[model samples]
Target chain A: MSHAIETIDLKKNYGSHAAIRGLSITVEPGTVFGLIGPNGAGKTTTLRMLLDVIRPSSGVARVLGETPQAGGPALRRRIGFVPGELRLEGRIRGRALLRHYAEISGQVAPGAVDDLADRLGVDLNREVRKLSKGNKQKLGLIQAFMHRPELLVLDEPTSGLDPLVQREFLTMVREARANGQTILLSSHVLSEIQQTADQVAVLSDGLIVAEGDVAALRLGRIRRVRASFTGIAAAALRQELDHLPTLRDIDIDVTGTEPVRLTATIDGDIDPLVKLLARHSVLDLAVEEPDLEESVLQLYGSSANGRNGEVRHG
Target chain B: MVRVLPVFRRSLGDSWRSLIGWSVGVAAALLLYLPLFPSIGGDGEMQQIIESMPPELVKTLGYEQIASGPGYTQGTFFGLIGFLLLVIAATAWGSAAIAGAEESGQLELTLAHGVSRSQYALESALAVLVKLLWLGLLAAALILALNEPSELDVTVLNVLGASKALVGLAFVSASLALLVGAATGRRSLATAAGAGIAVLGYVFNAIANQVADADWLRALSPYSWAYHEMPLSDGPDWAGLALLWGLGAVFAAAATLLLRRRDIIG
Candidate 1:
C-alpha cells in the first residue's frame, strides 16, 4: 500500500535537548494510524515536523511524496490538520475565520464548509474569542475536515471534549475512515484510538517501542484462570494437578478450612482441568483476564507504568 | 493575487468605517487650510514674514521656491500629505501585517498551510499596495480640485508623478514593517520600527538639505533623493523617483527572503 506520510530519521532539537531523536514512522494511505504515547512523548513535535511548522534539525519528511517545505501546497490542499492547541484571533467571528481558512487552503466544494460547521454543531457567527474550548475544537474540526481531505493529522483531538462529543468525534473519524481518508492521529488517551485505529504505534521517550495491528499487539496477553476448590486436600490436589502437567506451576492457598484458591498462568486446552473439577466440588472460581491496560504496563515496565495497575491511558 | 483581495477587503473592513471617518475628517482639516492659501501668496504679510526668515528655517517649512506659483503650493501639499499619511498608513500596514496576523492567529494558521514563505510575503505586499493606491487616489483628487489653475497648472502628469512617489515611499515604509514584523514576530515593534524609519528618513533629509556643505549626509537618508524639485513645481526627476522605487522593491524582496527562511510560530 502507498504511504500517505513518511518520515526518515526526523530529529528536532531545542538547544541541548533532542525532542524527537532519529524518529521514523510511516502511515499508510486509507488507514487510521494511531500514535500513542504519554505526554512529552514527541508526538506534537512529530506532527509539527510533518506540517512543516518547524524545521527539522536533520533528516527528511515527505507528505504525500512531496517535501513539506518546498511547494507542498498541492499536497496540503488535500490534507487536513488539527493542532493540540487552537489559538486564533478572538475578535473575528467564527464564520470569518472559516472563510479565511477556506480561502487560504484553496478551493473547496460549494457549501461544504457550512455543512461541516453544522455537523460539528459550531456557531460560526459567534466571535471566536468568546467560544468555549469545546466549541473551538469543533471549529478546528470544521476547518480540518471541511474540505474532505485525503489525509487528516489530528493532535490530541479530543482533549477538552465531553464524552458525548468525543463519541461524535469518533463517529466523524469512523466516517472519514469509511470514506478512505488516511488519518494519522496522536493522542495520550488510549481509548480514543482503542476502537478507531487499525494500527497503533506506541511512542515512549521519542522512540516507537512497539507498533502493529492493535488486535495483534493485544492478543495472547490476557489474564489466566484462577480457580479454588472445597472438600479437597490442598496438598493432594496440588500434587495431582502438577502430575497432570496441564495445571502445573500453581500457587495454592491453604489457610482456609473450606477451599483453596490456586492461581496459575493457564495456557490453552483446559478440557482435562474441567473434567477433573467435575469430579470434585469446585468453589469460588474466579478467572481474571489481564486487560490491554495491564499489557501496556507490562510492555513499558514499572517506571513508565501509571498508578501501578490502574491504567490511566487518557 | 485572487487570494489577497478578500484578505485586503477584510482587513480594510476591520477599520473601514473608522478609516473613512478619519479621511473625511482629514479632508475637512485640509479645507481649514484653504483660507490660509491667499495669505500664503507672496504679497501677504504671512508670505513677507516667511520671506524674511532665515533660509534654513524657510526651507524647514518648505518656503524656498514660491516663484514657481501653484506648483509650489501643490508640491508642499503632496510632501506634507505624503509624510503624514505614510506614518498612518505604515502603522496600519505594519500592525496589520504582524500584529494583525499574530492576534488573529491567521499568521500561524496561514503559515501552517502549504503557503510558501515567499507567497506570504508577496500577498502581504499586495495588501499594502491596495491601501497605498486607495490613499493615493484620494490625495490626487483632492489636490486637483483644490489646485490654482491661473498660476502653475498642476497637470495630470504631475499629479501622477507625485502620487507615484508618495506610493513608493508608503510601500517602502510598509515593506520595512513587514520585514521587522517577520523578524520580531510582533506587531508593535514592527509599527514602531517602520514609523521610526520614515521619521528618521524625513529628519535626515531635512538636516542634509539644510547643511548643503555636507554632501555625505545626503547618502544617509533614502529620502535625500526622493523629493527633488517638489511635485508639479518642476518636472519630476526620473532618477530620484527610480531610486525610491528600487529601494521599495529591494525592501520587499528582502522581507520575502527572510520570511521564507524563519520559523513563523516563533
Candidate 2:
C-alpha cells in the first residue's frame, strides 16, 4: 500500500538547538495518524517541514509520494493544512476569506465551504475580528477542509474550541477518513488522539518515545483497577495482594467491616492481577485506561531517565 | 502557475478602503493646489517677493523658476507635496504586502493553501503597483480637469508625462520596500529602507541642483530622474523613465528569488 506521508530521518535545527532530531514515520493512505506530543515536542516543526513552509536541516519528507519542497505549489494543492496558530484577515468576513482560499486551490465544489461552516456552527458573515477564538478556529478548519484534499495535516486542531465544537471537529476528521483522506493530526491532548487516531506516535524531546496501535498501547501501558469485595477482610485482602508482580501502589479501605475496597495500578500485563482477584470474593471491579495527561507525564518521566542514561553512556 | 489572481483580488478587497481614502486625498490636494496657479503665476508682486528671496532657499524648495505656469505647478505640487504623498502611500503598501502579513500570521496560512513563495511575492508587488497606478491616474485626471480653468499652459500630454514619472518614481520606492520586506520579513526594516531611499534621493537631487560640482550625484538619485527635465513642461524623459522602471523590475525580481530561497518565519 502506498504511504500518504513519509519522513526519513527528518531533522530541523536552529543553530545548536534541534527542533526535530532524526525523526522517521509513515502514514498509510486513508488512515488517521496522530502525532501526540507536549508543547515544544517538535510537532509543529515536523508539520511545517512536511508543508515545505520551512526547509529541513537534513533528511527528506514526502507527501503523496513526492518530495514536498520539489513539489512546490502543485504538491500543496493536494494537501490541506490547519496551523496551530491560526490568524485570519480581520477586515474580511469569514466567508470571504474562505472563498479566497477556495479560489486559490481551485478544487472546492460550490457551496462546500458553506456546508462545512454550517456543520461546524460558524457564522461566515461575521468579520473575522468580531468572531470569538472558537469561531475563528472553525473558519480556519473550514478553509482547510473545504477543498476535500487527499491528505489533511492539522496542528492542535481542537485548541481553543469548546467541547461540543471539538467533538464536531473530530466528527469531521472521521468523515474525512471515510472519504479515504489520510490525516496527520498533531496535538498535546492524548484523549483527542485516542478517540480518533488509528495509530499514534508519542514524541518527547524530538524523538518518538512510543508508537503503536492505540488499543495495543492502552493495553501495554498502565491501567487503574478498582475492586470492591464482600466476605473478605481488608487486612487479608492486602496480604493476599502483596508482592503481586503486576500491581503497584496498592491501597485497601474497609468501611466499618461492611465491605472492603481495593485500588491499585497495574502495569505491562493484567493476567497476573486477574488470577489474584479470582482468589478473592470480588463483588465489583472496574478497569480504566490512564487519562492522557497522566499517560504523558509517565511517558516523559520514564523517557527523561532513559535519555539521561544514554547521555551518560555517550 | 499557482493562480495569483485570488491573491490579487483579496489584496484589493482588504485595502479598498485605504485606496479610496488615498484617491480622495490626492484629489483634494490637486484641486486645492492647481486652482491657485493662475493667481500665483500672474501676480507681479508675488514674483518680486520670490525673486528677492535667497537663491539657496529658492533652489532648496524647487521654486527657482516659479513665475511661469509650468514652473509654479512643478514647484508647488509635483516636485514637493505630490511626490511625498505618493511615496508615503507606496511605502506603506509595500511594507504591508509581505512583512506585515507575515508578522500577523496571514502569510503562513495563505502559503499553506498552495501559493508558491515566488507567486506570493510577485502578486503582492503587483497589487501595490495597481494601487499606485490608481492614485497616479487620479492625480492626472484631476490636473487635466483644472488645466484650462487654472490657466496652466501644460498640455494633457505633459500632464500625463509628469504623472508617468511620478508613477515610475513611486514604483522604484515601493519595489525597494517590497524587496527588503520579502528578504527580511520585517515591516519596520522595509519601511526604513524605502523611506531612506526616498530621503537620500531627494537630498542628493536637491544638493546637486544647488552645487554645480555635485551634478554627478543626480545620476545616482531616482528623484533627479523623475524631475530633472521638469516633465510637466517638457515631455517625459525617456531615459529616466527607462531607468526608474528598470530599477523597479530588478528589485521585484530579486525579491522573488530571495523569498523562494529563504525560510518564512512567523
Candidate 3:
C-alpha cells in the first residue's frame, strides 16, 4: 500500500518569503504523525499544501496515492481537517453547524457528531457565537472527527482546549489510530505530540529540521528539576551533583544566602540523580514537565541533527 | 450522498434575518413612494417643477418623467432609490460569500470538506441569485399591489419585468464583487469592486445624458442596458435583461476560474 502522505521536496512561497522550503516526509498508513513547529514554522503551510487548500510553489506531494490537485474533492473527503485558528461564527446552534458540515462531508456516521461532543464535554445546543473559545475549538474538532475520515489533518487542534478536553482529544486520536486511521496532527506543544504521536517531524524556518521516532526522542529528552536544600552550600552541592551519570546544565543559586537552590536539566536515567539528591536535606522539590517548545527544540534541534529528514538552506 | 448545494443552502440560511430586513425595507419603499404619486405625480405641478428645474438636473435624476405612473415608478424607485437598496444588499452578499468568509476562516474549513472550490463559487453565486430574486419578488409583489391604487398604470407583467431587470442589474454588481473576492480574498477590495461597477455604470449613463454625441456611451453602461429602454414604461427590455444576466454569468465564471487557480490563505 502507498504511504498515507508523501511529500518530496515540496516548497511553498508567499511572494519572496518562503513559508515551506523543500519539506519531505513519508507518513505510514495507520499511525499518528506529528508536525511539530513554532508559530511561523511552516507547519500549517505544509498541511494546507497537502490538502490543496494552498498551492505549493514547487515539488511533489502525493496524498493517499494522488496529487492533491488531481485528487480534489475525492481526496478531501477521505481527510478530516481542523484549522489552526478555529473561527466558528453564526447564530445557529453548534449542533446545526456540525450538521451542516456532516451534510457536506456526507460520509459522517449518524450520531458521530453527538458522540464527539459528548466526549469533549461540549454542549451542542448553544449558539456558536455564544460558545467560549475553547468550546468553539471543540466544535472544530467535532466537525473534523465526526466523519471518521481515513486521514485526519489537524492543525493546533488542542490549542484552545482545556487540559481535560485535550486529554480526551488525545484519547480520540489514539482511538482513531486503533481504528486504522492515519493522522497528521500539527501543534507547537511538544508534550501534546509526545503523548500521542508515534513519529514526529520538527519543522523550523520552512524546513524539517529533525525527524525521528517519538519513542527515541522521548527517551532522549531532557527533564528539568528544581530542588531547594536546608543547609547545602552551592559550590559543594554542584561539586557533588556534577559526578552524577546523566545530569547536565546544573545551576545552584538562592539570590541570597539561606536555602540554596539546585536546578538541573538532566537526560537519560534519573535513578543516580535521585539517589544523590536524597543524601541532601531537601526542602522544596519540584520536577516540572519541561517547557513544551523548549524541550522540543532541544530534542529535535541537537540530537536529531545529521539524521534522516533534516534539511538545511544556505 | 452529499447534500446538493449545501453551500448555497447554508449561505441563504445564515442570512435569513438580513433577507427579512431587506424584504421589509423594500415593502417600506413601496409604501413610501408609490402611494404618493397622486399628490406629486400627474398633477402638472410636478411636471412644472421639473420644467422649472435645470434641464440637466431633471435628465440626470430621470425626474422629467415623474408626471406619469410608470415614469414615477422608474424615477423614484427602479432607477434610483430602490436600485441602490438592492445593489447594496447584493454587494454585501457577494463580498461575504468569499472574501468575508475566507477572512473569518469559515471558507477554508468549509472547503476542507468534500466540496470543490468551483462548486463553492458556483453555489455562492446561486445563493446571491436566490437572495436577489427574493428581494425582487417582494418588490414586484408590493409594486403590483399598488399598481391600480397609485395610478401606476404599468401592467402586472410589466412590473414583474422591471423587477426582474432590477435583480439582474444588481446581480451584475454581486457577481463582479464575487469575482474580485475570489481573486484577492479581501472583503474591502471586493466591496469596492462591487460598488465601483455600480458607480461606473451610473456615471457613464449620467455623463451620456449631458453629451449629445455620447449615445454610444449607453452601450457601455450597465445602467443604460437595464434602464435606457425604459422597461418600466415601454416594456421589458429583453436584450437589456439578457445582457445583464450574461454579464453576471461571465463574472461568476471568472470568479470560479480565479478561485480554482489560487490558494485559500485563510
Candidate 4:
C-alpha cells in the first residue's frame, strides 16, 4: 500500500538532548494513524519534523512522496498542519484568519470555512485571543481541514477541549477519514486514540516501543484475571500467594481479605495456575478480558519497561 | 497574487492607527508652516527676515530661493513638511510590513499555508507597494490643494517630485524594517532599528545640505538624493531617485534571502 507519510530512522536533537531518536513509522493513505506517548516523548517534535517546521538532525522523512526539507511550496500545498501551541494574530477576527488561511491554501470552497466554524460552534467574529480554549482549538481544526488537504498533521489537537467537543471533533475526523484523508494525530490521551485510530504506535524515550494494527497490539497485551481461594488463613494465604512465580502480586483488601485475594498481570501463557487453583478449595474465580487502556499502558505507559507487553505490576 | 491581498488588507487595516498618529505630526508641521505662508504673501518683514536668517537655517528648511515671494511658501514651508511626511509614511509602511507581523505571530500562520518564506517576503513587499500608492495619493491631494493658485506648473512639478520622493523613502524604510525583521525575531528590535535608520537618514540629509561640498555624505543618505530634486527650487534628480530605489530593492532581496534560511515560527 502506498503510504501518505513515512519516516526512516528519523532523529532530532535539541542541543545535547535527543527529542526523537531512530524513529520510523508509516501511515497509509486514508487511515487514521495515532502516535501515542507520554508527555515529552517527542510526539510533537516528530510532528513538527513531518510538517517541515523543524529540521531533523539525521535520517529522512517523506510527506506525500516528497522530502519535506527540500519540498518547497508545491509539496506543502497537499498538507495541512495544526501546531501544538497555536498563536494567531490577536487583532484579526477568527473568520478573517480562517479566510486568509483558506485563500493561502488555495482552491477551497467559498463558504467552507464558515460552514466548519458554524458546525464547530466557533464564533468566527470574536478575536482569537479572546476566544476560549475550545473555540481556539475549533479554529485551528477549521484551518487544517478547510483546504481539504490530503494529509492532516495535528499535534495535541484536543487540548483544553471538553469531552463533548472532543467527541464531536473525533466524529469530524471520522468523516475526514471516510473522504480518503490521511491523518497523523498525536495525543497522550488514551480514549482519544482508542476511539479513532486504526493503527497505533507507542513511543517512549524518543523511540517507538511498539506499532501495529490496534487490534493486534491489544490482543494479548492486557491482563485481567481474578482468583479466590480457601484452606489458608486470609493474611497468610495472601502472603503465600505473592510468592507464586506466575502470580507475582495479590491485593488482599480489594480481593476481600479472607482465604481469597486476586492477582492480575500479563498472562505469560500460563494455564497450569488455573489447574493448580482447581485442586485448592476455590470459592470464586474470574478471568476478565483486558481493555484498550490496559493494552496501551502495557505498551507505552511509563510503568511498562521497554518490553513486549510484559507488564509485571498488577 | 490573491494570497497577497490579505497581507495588503491587513496592512491597510493596521495602518489606520499610524494614519491617526501621522495626522498629529501633520498638525504640528502645518502649524510650523502657517507662520511662513504670511512671509510668502509679501509681508514687510519677509526680506528683512530673509536677510537676517543664516544660510545653514535656510539649507535646513530647503530655502535656497527664499528671497522670491513664492519661495517661502513653496520651498521652506512645504520642504520641511514633506520631509516629515515622508518620515512618518515610511515608518508606518515599514513597521506594518514587517515588525507588525512578527509581533502578531501572523507570519507563522501565513507561512504555514504552502507559503514559502520567499513568497511571504514577496507578499510583504507587495503590501508595502500598496501603502506607497495610498500614501502617495494622499500627499498628492494635500499638495494639490495647497498649490491651487496661478503657478500651476511649478506646483504640480513640486507635488510630483514629492510623490516620487515619498515612494523612494517608503521603500528605504520598508526594506530596512524587513531586513531587521528577518534577522531578529522580536518586533521591538526591528522597529527600533527602523526608527534609528530613519533618524540617521534625516541627520545625514541635514549634514549634506549644510555642507554641499560633502558629496560623499550626500550619497550616503537616501534623503540627500531626493532633497537635491527640490521641485520648488530646481527639478527632479532622476538618477539619485533611481539609486534610492535600487538600494531599496537590494535590501528587500536580502531580507527575502534571510527569511528563507531562518524559521519564521521560531
- Writing each residue's lDDT as its tens digit, candidate 1 over B24-58 gives 74466445553356556534555566667897876
For candidate 2, chain B by itself scores a TM value of 0.97
- Which regions of candidate 3 are displaced past 4 Å? A218-220, A254-256, A296-314
Candidate 4 interface RMSD after superposing interface residues: 2.7
Question: Per-residue CA lDDT of candidate 3, range B23-92, in tens?
Answer: 8888898899999998878788888888899998888988868899999999999999889999999999
Q: How good is model 1 by TM-score?
A: 0.76
**Best model number under DockQ:** 3
Better of 3 and 4 by DockQ: 3
- Model 4: residues with Cα > 4 Å off, grouped in runs: A12-20, A38-41, A69-71, A127-129, A203-210, A214-314, B1-6, B13-36, B39-89, B92-99, B148-154, B209-215
Comparing to the true complex, what docking class would candidate 2 get? Answer: acceptable
Please give each candidate's TM-score: 0.76, 0.88, 0.95, 0.77
Sort order, TM-score high to low: 3, 2, 4, 1
lDDT of 3 at A277: 85
lDDT of 2 at B233: 83
Write the residue-wise lDDT of candidate 1 on A189-295 in tens digits.
77677779988877666666567777665423434668878888888878777755644357888885766777875544566766776788887666555544444
Cα lDDT over the full model 2: 0.85
For all candidates, the clash counts are 3, 0, 0, 0
Candidate 2: residue B217 Cα off by (Å)? 1.7
Instruction: Specify the poorest-scoring 10-residue window by lDDT in model 1 chain B.
Output: B67-76
C-alpha positional error of residue A124 in candidate 1 after TM-score superposition, expressed in Å: 2.5
How would you class the docking of model 1?
acceptable
True contacts kept of each: 0.45, 0.78, 0.90, 0.48
